[model samples]
Target: MKKTIPFSLLALLLYLAAACSTPKQRVPEQTASYTPASQELYDTIARMDSVMFDAFNKQDPDKLKEVFSEDLEFYHDKGGVTDYAQTMENFRTLFERNRDTGLRRDLVKGSLEVYPIVGFGAVEICLHRFCHQENGQDDCGTFKNIMLWQQKDGKWKVTRVISYDH
Candidate 1:
């Protein structure tokens, strides 16, 4: 009597065939690294960053708003992405909530690195830490941020933000 192939064996063979039939390889492309920003530029950015964060820590929306571009795009790992208006709304909510507890953001010392983007503007890579006090309890954590700063209307404005690595 002739015997038929087992169902399990046939399924395994089919799966193996499907998986092995495709030869897939991911080739990564490289681009030139950004040029380092000049000291003067770095100093200017640092000062601007200081002002920006000071407003955040103090929950001052006006000061915080001035530092950002009207076409700002903010990306957060936990909260997703938003445009300038949404970001402002978020800031308003956050400021209202954390105003009493005194939320603060501090850049890790020597952790900020700046790069020039040839023509448009510059990029800032930095590690920042946040701390806040609430309900007689203290909480804190550190995260990474990549900010795209552009010059517009004769002043520097942050156009984009990538906040991640919590």
Candidate 2:
């Protein structure tokens, strides 16, 4: 004698079969073309990088503050997190303490990933921090940086910066 399957079991099998047969959704790949406005924004961000690097090398707190948003957040390699005001204060204190100290950054590699309203940049940087030590040595290392930028008032301003040694 043949046995009959329950109605609920048959429905479950049909649902499983339909789900298995459906194709998975795919994410679109990034393309190279950029809109005119996006290109303008990219150029502005690139220029901002130069300004920021110059401020860092010069240890100018006012210049650094101009590049950063009012609600900026900074994550440092030495396990320290700072907000905009705190970061600016720290830079001021450092500049006052070591008047002769200097720092420079070299951009090794960088890329910008743009979204609808925001963009993120990944940069590999080499840092050289010099001070008048006993042996006159310089602290040097390579670090990977991730920066988040947002378009505000027709310009791109850095909202967050995170860096770690490479």
Candidate 3:
């Protein structure tokens, strides 16, 4: 008598076959025509970027604090990692140092990208430049910045930041 394959064995084989299938790798498009998943989200984050940096340019530490979460994590290429308190203190010091000439932050035109994070608020990627008057001339540095925004109680704040490539 010929024996037939058991149902359990067939099910296991099917499961194994499905498990062995490769998953498609997801990568963000790097083209000039890249678009955000949500235009409203893009606009909101863009506005937040402008407002946050405006406070920074104006040397308003308190205003900046409003935009940064209490659990903020700042990662800088040269200065290393910093917590919320430390980052705030650093900004205060920077403002004091540049009190005369003053520092300004400008977002590179068409460099901003916003991506939704499901349950979280969003992620913002962009290039920005910080400029200051130095020796009767404008001194500037451009850098790549990534920010994770968290929305709670109808308010949004930056939870994490990666500032690099200075």
Give lDDT per model, in order: 0.83, 0.64, 0.91
Worst 10 residues of 3 by lDDT: 22-31
lDDT by residue (1-166, candidate 2, tens digit) is 9999999999999999988896432222324553334565556656767788788778788888887888989898885889999988987887787666555565443334333353444221223222333347664545556677766676667788787653
Write the residue-wise lDDT of candidate 3 on 70-143 in tens digits.
Answer: 99999999999999999999999999999988689988887899999999999999988788999998787778
* All models, RMSD in angstroms: 10.2, 14.2, 14.4
Q: Extract clashing residue pairs from model 1.
A: none
Model 2 / residue 91 / CA error / Å: 1.2
lDDT, candidate 1, 26-136, per-residue tens: 222223444445987777778888999999988889898899999899999999999999999999998888877869999877777787777777888887878899679
* Decreasing TM-score order of the candidates: 3, 1, 2
lDDT, residue 11, candidate 1: 100
Candidate ordering by lDDT (highest first): 3, 1, 2
